[model samples]
Target: MNRSNTTALTQPGAPMKVRNVSKRFGAFTALDDVSLDVAAGELVCLLGPSGCGKTTLLRCIAGLERQDSGVLYLGDRDVSDLAPQARDYGILFQSYALFPNLSVEANIAYGLAGSNRDVVRKRVGEMLDLVGLSGSEKKFPGQLSGGQQQRVALARALAPAPSLLLLDEPMSALDARVREHLCTELRQLQRQLGITTLMVTHNQDEAMLMADRIAVMNNGKVEQYATPQDIYDKPATPFVAEFVGQGNWLPFQRSSDSHANVGGMSMRLAAGAGQAASGRLFCRPEAISVNPLLHEENLFPARVREITFLGNRCRMSFELNQLPGHALTAEVGSQDLPRLGAQDIFVALPPESLQVFA
Candidate 1:
């Protein structure tokens, strides 16, 4: 494939807008008043647990399933009523969905059926090269490894250069090591082509690594939509805080707009944490410092009940002396393991690391 000819197959991605979209399967509501927008050239992940309506929403946007009520727009064009073929998008599925009988080149060229023969051949070769499958063109899907087959599927999906790309757990079938490598490659390719992409995944780590923004969904509604860091560091809801990452929820009593008491130890609160009289204080295990100095404001005594070595870090579970039944988990670096002696230790919960939700 000629490098200069690649331009003919590439198009700038278009922004996608979904307004108040809802879908129902008889008595069950699949999507409920869902609304979101993806900027041109941006990649967003519709992340959630199973049966959360993420795949349904992706199907709706792809025109495979119609919403009960709502509008869908691609750039300035309303595509809600358009057919799948008319929506100007390409999709890669979890199963790789390749034709067993077709060769890699033929599969990639499948969507280019009516194009000029030479042009189709050129586009196929270009796609193969783009996906790092240049030498495997003649091999059928059955002869390729799982990762290679997925690459072929991805190449086929991008062969048409659609303005939008939809991925339904595209890397879920590959092994962990392959999935991680392909994920990085896919992100690089998406950026290079600048395709407005929406991916559906139940994996939090995958979404964090790939998406520019994440629309976290649950039970037919988007729980939160934000950048990965914000979603993890400053979750909009308790569910978002718990689901997006690992954290401990401890009971706390609000003292004022900027202070709280946890297990009788006074600690500063985040600005808006005092809205509730009492609530659960969410703190990531990694946020707590084990055996900090006694001068720390939120320092508390705890007996190390169990310690688990996790490579570079050690995970320790502590039974808080102030609250016997309650326990907090802390991740201490391997270098600090010796500092945590055989007795009770001091744990500090910094105010900035605490998120309170009523």
Candidate 2:
């Protein structure tokens, strides 16, 4: 809906806190002492692989699944024991949970059943307009495409103007192109509404694109909670580094606090490298330059075993001459491939870009 007309949807958001929440189903622990803070008007993403407790956590916050322990607070109020109906939040599931028999307008107006007719009508219209589905009010869920149905579900969730929004893999069913487009639209709308939001998704690209911060979860525990850039560039754990982006790991012997021997070469590492004598050295694929124009500290003679083009970039399999049996991958700009020849090719690992973990 247009901001000028929908006053209720513009209400300021509230903070949400999940404090030491834990849940278990028989022998499986879905959430193990999980906790996080969602600031007022902030968007946080619960990012992880399937069965990582992200969805379980979202359900707990929505009161659909009660935690076995801990408390939940919404805007300084204890909402731990409240029922789902009493929680001032709206949720949209992956399935887009619309009644096949109901029209789009009816679905959007479902939450306002007890409200006056005029109020419900106005709210439904505003929601449909806000989601860019203004003219499809009469269409049934069966008649709408997957993307359209997703927008309808979004409109339904916002109809009540809830203070918080919980989305569980909302765009997972859509095609890549549609998912990308809707991610932009949904993020813009959420910001405009100023609603605190938590979204669960296995897609790193979506989380990075939409969330102000991401909580990377693994095996029912939070591995890292930070901004998207921080999660990618300064991962707190090995699971986070491997999950959030593409990287290469090398088993190496630690020579000093800032040095390691990897791929049969002595390499300089960034400060804060772990102290373990033997550890794994991690470097993002993009950080490794093949035949770099600038001088590098850990440069070595390397051979390209394979080159796979991926539009703007090329993924090249690399093997250092000193470590012929070992392989590493380097991502270089496609346009720069012409500058290299069949000889003198080198792989440069910038010290400041390398991370060591035991």
Give a tens-digit lDDT track for model 1, residues 1-358.
Answer: 2233444456999999999999999999999999999999999999999999999999999999989999999999999999999999989999989999999999999988899999999888889878777888899999999999988998889888899999999988889999999898889778878889999999999999999999999999999999999999889888788788888998889877888877787778766543777989889999998888456657778898899999999999888898887877999898899878985888888888988888
Clash pairs for candidate 1 = none
In candidate 1, residue 99 scores what lDDT?
97
lDDT of each: 0.89, 0.89
Q: Model 2, 1-358: lDDT tens per residue?
A: 3444544665678999999999999999999999899999999999999999999999999999999999999999899999998899988999999999999999999988899999998888888888778889899999989999999999899888788999999999999999999999889888878899999999999999999999999999999999999999988888998998898888898777677877558888777655678878788999998887888889999888888999999998888888877778889889988987774489898887887777
RMSD of 1: 1.9
CA shift at 195, candidate 1, in angstroms?
0.6
Q: Which 10 consecutive residues of model 2 have the lowest summed lDDT? A: 1-10
Once fitted onto the true fold, the runs of candidate 2 whose alpha carbons sit more than 4 angstroms away are 1-8
Overall local distance difference test of candidate 1: 0.89
